[model samples]
Every structure is written in C-alpha cells, then in structure tokens.
Target: MLATVIHAARDIRVEEVPDPELSGSGADAIVRVVAACVCGSDLWPYRGVTPTDAPHRIGHEFVGVVESVGADVEHVKTGDFVIAPFYVCDGTCVNCRNGVSTSCVQGSWWGGSDRSGGFADGGQGERVRVPLADGTLAVVPGPVGDDEIPGLLTLSDVMGTGHHAAVSAGVGPGDSVAVVGDGAVGLCAIIAAKRLGATTIIAMSRHADRQALAREFGATHIVEERGDEGVAAVQDLTGGIGADRVLECVGTKESMDQALRSARPGGMVGFVGVPNGGPELPVRQMFNRNVGVNGGVAPVRGYIDELMDDVRSGAIRPGRVFDLELPLSQAAEAYAGMDERRATKVLLRP
Candidate 1:
C-alpha cells in the first residue's frame, strides 16, 4: 500500500509500505480509506516541532468503510461505513464514561504508535486496521457519497473539537462569543457557538476568506485585528464587557491571551488549540476577573454521534472547511497548501 511517510522535517513522501495486520488483544476493524483530512496540528510534525525519529504515518481524521472485523467486534461488520475517532479509547475507562476520552488513561493517538496511523499506511492508503473497534469507530447511517464524505469526515476530529470548545465555554442564547482562530477548527468553533444559541459570534480572523466563512458559520462580527487591538475589538462588540464566552482555537501564547482578555468578567473561555509555543497564563488577571478557563485536547470520540445527527439533518455543514482536495499521492502538496494558508483545510481521497 502507498502511504505518506514523514522520515524527517519537511520530508513527507508517498511510498509503498506493508499493510497493517490485526495483532492487538481487542476488537479490531479494518476500514477502507474513503476521505481523510490534513490537520493544522499535523503541521507540527511536518515542521519538526514534534519528534519522529522513525518514518511515521501522519493523519488522524478520516471516514471509511469497514473491510473486516476481529472476533470480538459486534457493533459493526464488514462493508459498514464508519468514522474512526482520532483517539483510541477504552470506553469503560473513567474518563471515557465522563465524556473526556481524550484524557483516557489508556487512550491511543492515531499515527503516533508503532500501530501506524490513518495518514499514510493508515487512512491515507487503501485500507487500515482500527484497534478497539467497538469503542473507536462509529458507523455512519446510510451509504455516503463523495459529496457527503467531507462533512462526515469532519466528525472524526475538527468538527467535534470545535463543538467541544463551544460547549465547554458555556455559549448560550443571546450570548456574545469570540472565536480566536481562523483555521478549520476555529471556523467550526464559530459554527458550534451558533448551534449552541449564541446570537453574537465575534470571529477574530486576519484572512478575508476565513473571515467570510466565519460569517457563513454564524459569526455576527469579524475582527481583523491582533494583540490588544483584537481584544479591544471583541470588547467593543460586546458593549465594552468583552464576550460572554471566548473560544480559543489557536494554541499560541498570543492567541491564549487574546482569548482570556476577550472574555467578560466571570465568563468562560474554552480552548482546544494544541499549544505550540510556550504560552504563559496570566494567573493574576484570571483571578482578578474571576474568569473560568477550561479546555484541553478535544475528546472527539464522545461528540461524534450528536454531531453526526446535526450533519445528517443539514443543520451544520462542517464540510465547507475543506477548501482544497487532492489525491492521497499528493499528500505533500496538501500539507504545503495548508502551511502556506492557501487552503483552510485539505481533503485527500484515497
């Protein structure tokens, strides 16, 4: 099978690799790659921010069809269309039971293990094996076509993460929410805020294209500022009180500070950006304002079902986040497009 292999920084290639075999002592499922996406977080590995000495397959968001199942797998069967969650969780764990499976004690991240990933030898290929199938894979209702695959694939990661961010931040009816990012996940956060009943969604974006999408996703206002000016704009939109809830979708220190400063006193900030640079928290400011900060790596597994219903009902069109599409063979191009901000999100068809 041909898979995307990252042997070093800025060194991603599509090459033939041995297919993965089921060897884990748990329910397993083999899924044929249908639609997979390039994530902003994937850029970390691509740029050598994350260590990878050996050739690593790099992908986590994907939707596919089941090709085979292990003996213990019962929830799904061969031929079933499914979306694999980015995190491999043991559903019975304490965190999983509480809908925090991303922090599950036994959670497994796709593509980071010897087990390979859905990116190259995984979902970016013809097929890939999914461990803990009963817990990690969700079967999509009805047959999915090419058009619907992009939206469905978002449930595997970005869409769910965005929803989690909005929910955690306590976005509610008539509330003003500020989303601090213009990437796919940030755009999804805007959509999530809208779905949660926020009336005034303030999207802080520097790009016109992303700002336009933010409006489409229900942002009532767009702030094309940064630093203190960005925070002031958000506060101005909220009548000088700051947003009722702020969704921090970028993990940098500046983004985090913007999120904190953009929220009203006693308000909540939900952050899900994978912190890239070392971001220091202004504890004194947070304490003085009594601001509630809550966020972490999104546990996408828990929100898949609810989000699927919204997608199926057409209440949300998360697929719009994918502005570029390429064949799996051109995965490197996909990465370049996203890194250069030429595309909001890149979808690869295997």
Candidate 2:
C-alpha cells in the first residue's frame, strides 16, 4: 500500500508500506480508507514545531468503510461507512459519560504512539486499523453521495471542533459572536454560531477567499484587522461592548489574546486551537471584566451523530471548506498549500 510518510521536517513523501495488521479483539476494527484530510493541527508536526521521529503517519480526520471488526465491536459492523474521531475514547469512561470524550480517562490521542493515526501508515493507505472501533467510529446513516463525502468528513473533526467552540462559549439567541482565525475550523465556528442562533457573527480574517466563505457560513461581519485593532473592530461592531461570545481557532498567543479581548465583560471565550506553546492568560484583564474562558481540544466523538444528521440534511455545508483536493500521493502539496495559506483545507482520496 502507498502512504504519506513524514520522514523529517519539511520532508514528506508517498511511499509503499506494509499494511497494518489487526490483532486486538477488544473493540477494534479495520477500515478501508475512502477519504482523508490534511488538518491545520497536523501542520505542527509537518513544520517541526512538534518533535517527531522520521517516517510517522500524519492524518487523523477520515471517513471509511469497515473492512472488519473485533469480536467485541457491536456498535459497527463490516461494510459500515463510518467517520473516525481524531481521539479514541471508550464511550463508557467516566469522562465520556460526562460528555467529555476528549478527556476520556482511557482515551488516547488519535495518531499518537500508543494508537496509530490514519495519515500515511493509516487512512492514507488503502486500509487502516482502528482501535476502540465501537466508540471511535460513527456510522454514517446511509450511502453518502460523493458530493456529500466532503461534508460528512468534516464530522470527523473540524466541523465538530468548531461546534464545540460555539457550544462552550454559550452562543445563544441574538448573541453577538466573534470568531478568530479563518481556517476551516474557524469558518465552521461561524456556522456553528449561526446554528446556535447568534444574531451577529463576526469573523476576523484577511484572506478574501476565507472571508467569503465566512459570510456564506453565516458571519454577519468580517474584520480584516489583526491584533488589537481586530479586537477593537469587533467591539465597535457590537456597540463598543465587544461580542457576547468569542471563539478562538488559532493556537498562537496573538490569536488567543484577540479572542480574549474581543469578548464583552462577563462574556465567554471558547478555544479549540491546539496550543503549541502554552499561551498566557490575561488574568488581570479577565478579572477586571469578569470574563470566563473555557475550551480545549474538541470532544468530537460526542457531537458526531447530531452533526452527521445536520450534514446529511443539508442544513450545514461545512464541507465547502475543502477548497483543494488531491490524491493521497500528493500529500506534500496539500501540506504546502495549507502552510502558505493558499487553501483552507485539503482533502485527499486514496
């Protein structure tokens, strides 16, 4: 099988590799790769920001058909089309039961050493093994049209993460919301805010394409400014009171600061961006304004079902974020396009 292998920083290649073997019997399954996507979070390892040994698999968000299932796997069966959550968690765990599968006590990060990811050696290939299949994989309701696959794939990660950000911020009827970052996840955050009944959705972006998509996703306002100016722009649009809720989709300190500053006093800030270097909190500013900050890596597993229905019904078109598509063999080009900010999200077909 051919897979995308990141041998070193700025070095990625499509290479023939041995397929993964399935030996686990406790809630495990093997899936035939249908489609996979390059993620902004994956860029951390691609750019050497995260230390990784050469030749590691690189993808996490994917949709596939089940090729096989372990004896204990009951939620899914062979031939089932499913979306794999980026995090593997047992739905029965204490944290999972509390609706926090992202922090499942027995869960592991998707594509980590303990559990192989779906990038190169995983979903980027013809087939991949998924551990904790019963909990990690969400079965699609029925056969999805090719046109719907992109949106269905979003249920695996980005769209779910974006929805998590909006939910965490408590976006409600007539609320004013601000979304920082214009990546796929950020654009979806705008959609999520709209779905939550936000009256004014503000997207902070400089890219014309992404800005356009933001509007399509329900952003009522677009702030092209950066840093403090961007925060002020959001405030001005909200009668100088700032947004009622803010979603931070960029992990950088600058983006985090903007999210914090863009929220009104007593407002909430929800962040889903993977913090590469830990960001500092403006404790004094937050205290002065009585602001509340919450959010972490999204618990996508918890929201997949509802999101899947929305996608299938055409209520949300988060899949439009995939402005570029390529074969698995061109994984490097996908990375380059994202790194250069030329594409919001890239989709790959095996």
Candidate 3:
C-alpha cells in the first residue's frame, strides 16, 4: 500500500508502505480508507514551522469502511462505514468518561506508533490499523453514497472541533458570536454557532471566497479587517459591546489576542487552534473585564455521534469546506494546494 510521508520541510511524498494487520491484544482494527485530507495542523510540519525529527507518515482526519476487526471489538464489524477521530483512546478510561477523550490514559495518535509500540499508519493512506478499535471508531449507518462521504469525513475532526469551540464558549440561543480564522475549522464554527442557536454570527475573514462561504454557513456579518480594526468591526455590529461568545479557531498570538479582544466584557473565548507561536493570556486584561478563556485540543470523539446525526439528516453541510479533491497518488499536489492557500481543504480518494 502507498501512504504519505513527510521527509522534511516542503518535502512530501507518497510511497509504498507495509499493509496493516491486527495486533497482539486483538483490540485493533484495519480500516480501508475511503477518504482522507490534510489538516491545518499538518501544515505546521509541512511549512517547517514544526520540526520533523525523522521521516514519518502524515495526516489525521479520515473516514472509511471497516475491512477487519479484532477479537475484542464489538461495537462495529467488517464492512461498517466509520469515522476515525484524530486521536485513538480507550473509551472506558477516566478521561474519556469525563468527555475529554483526547486525554484518555491510553490515548495515541495516527501516523505514529501505538501504545504497544506497533506502527499505526496515517489516515492519508490506503489502509490504517486503528488502535482501541471498539472505543475509537464511530459507525456511520450505511449504505452511504459517495456524495455523503465528504460531509461524514468532517466528523473525524473539523466539524466536531468547531462544535467543541462553540460548546466551550457557551454559545446559546439569542447570543451574539464571533469566529476568528476563516479556514475549514473556522467555517465549520459558523455552522456550529448556527446549530447552537446563536442569532448573530460575526465571521472575521478577508478572502472573498471564504467570506461568501462564511455567510452561507450562518455568519450574519463579515469583518474583513483584522487586529484593532477587526475588533472594532465586531463591536460595531454588536452595538459597540463586542460579541457575547468568541470562537478562536486559529492558533497564533495575533488570532488569540484578536479573539480575546473581540468578546464582550463578560464573554468567553473558546479556542481550538493547535498552538504554533506561543499565545499568552494577559492576566490584567482578563481580570479587568470579566472575560474567560477555555478550550484545547478538541476531543472530537465525544461529539461524533451528535454531529453525525445532523450530517446524516442533512441539517448541515460542513464538508463544503473541502473545495479540492484529488487521488491518493496525487498527495504531493494536495499538500501544495493547501500550502499555497489555493484550497481551503483538500480531500484525497484512495
């Protein structure tokens, strides 16, 4: 099988790799990937912002059909369509029970070694060996059509992540909301804000295409300016008081500061962007206003079932963020398009 490997900065290649199989505990499963995509986080490594110690597999978000399951796996079986969250966790762990599955005691990630020291292939490949199979995989009732695959794939990461940001910020019915960043996750945040009944959604974006999509996804107002200008724009839309809840989807000092400043004195900021440049919280600023900040790496597994319902029912189309699609063999091109900002998100078919 062929899988994507990042050798170094700006170097991405698809090369033949070993096929995955069940592991010793019979707690693993092998999934034949139907679709996978590069994430904003993946770009950190691609752009050399995040150092690559050694060549390794890349990619995290994916959805596929179960090719096989281990002896202990019970919730799903062969041929079931499933969404694999970016992180692998034992569902019964204390952290998982508390709704923070990403912190599960036995949690691990794809494109890396499993807890047992065995290889776990990345999602951007022909197949993957899923750890904690029973706890990690969420079944998507099928027979699902090709048209629905992209939307379902979003449940693997971005859609669930966007939902986490909204939930953390305590976005409620009739509340005004602001979303920072206009990437796939940010656009999905707009969908989540609307789903949570936020009446006023302010999307901060300067790109024409993203701005159009933000409106389609439920952003009632668009603020093209950034920094102080952007914060002022959001405040003006909200009667000079700022948004009641702010969702920060970009992980940068600038974006974090913007999110914190764009909220009303009592508003909360929910952030999910993977930290690239260290972003600090000003104690005095947060104290002066009654503002609060909450959110971290999204525990997407916990939100999958609920979000999947909406995806299945066509209540939301978060997959619209995937504006580009290519074959698995063209993995290099997919990375380039995203790095160049030519595609909001790219989907790969194996």
Worst 10 residues of 2 by lDDT: 112-121
Estimated TM-score for each candidate: 0.96, 0.96, 0.99
Write down the lDDT of every candidate, Cα atoms only: 0.85, 0.86, 0.94
lDDT of 3 at 177: 99
* Per-residue C-alpha lDDT of model 2 across residues 1-350, encoded as one tens digit per residue: 77777888778888887776665555678888899988898788789998777577667888989988878889899999999888778788899999999887767754444443332135555677777788788998677788989998998899999999999999899999999999999999999999999999999999888888999999999999977788789989999989999999988998988889899999999999888698789899999998898988899999998788888889999999999999988999999999988888999998
Clashes of 2: 2
TM-score of 3: 0.99
Instruction: Please give, for residues 213-290, the per-residue lDDT of candidate 1 as tens digits.
Output: 899989999999888898888888888999999999989998898999999999999999988877778899999998
Instruction: Give candidate 2 regions above 4 Å deviation.
Output: 113-121
Candidate 1 Cα RMSD after full superposition onto the native fold (Å) = 2.1
Over the stretch 238-332, how does candidate 3's per-residue lDDT look in tens digits? 99999999999998999999999999999999999987778678979989998999999999999999898798788999989999999999988
Report clash pairs, candidate 3: none
Full ranking by lDDT: 3, 2, 1
Candidate 1: residue 116 Cα off by (Å): 14
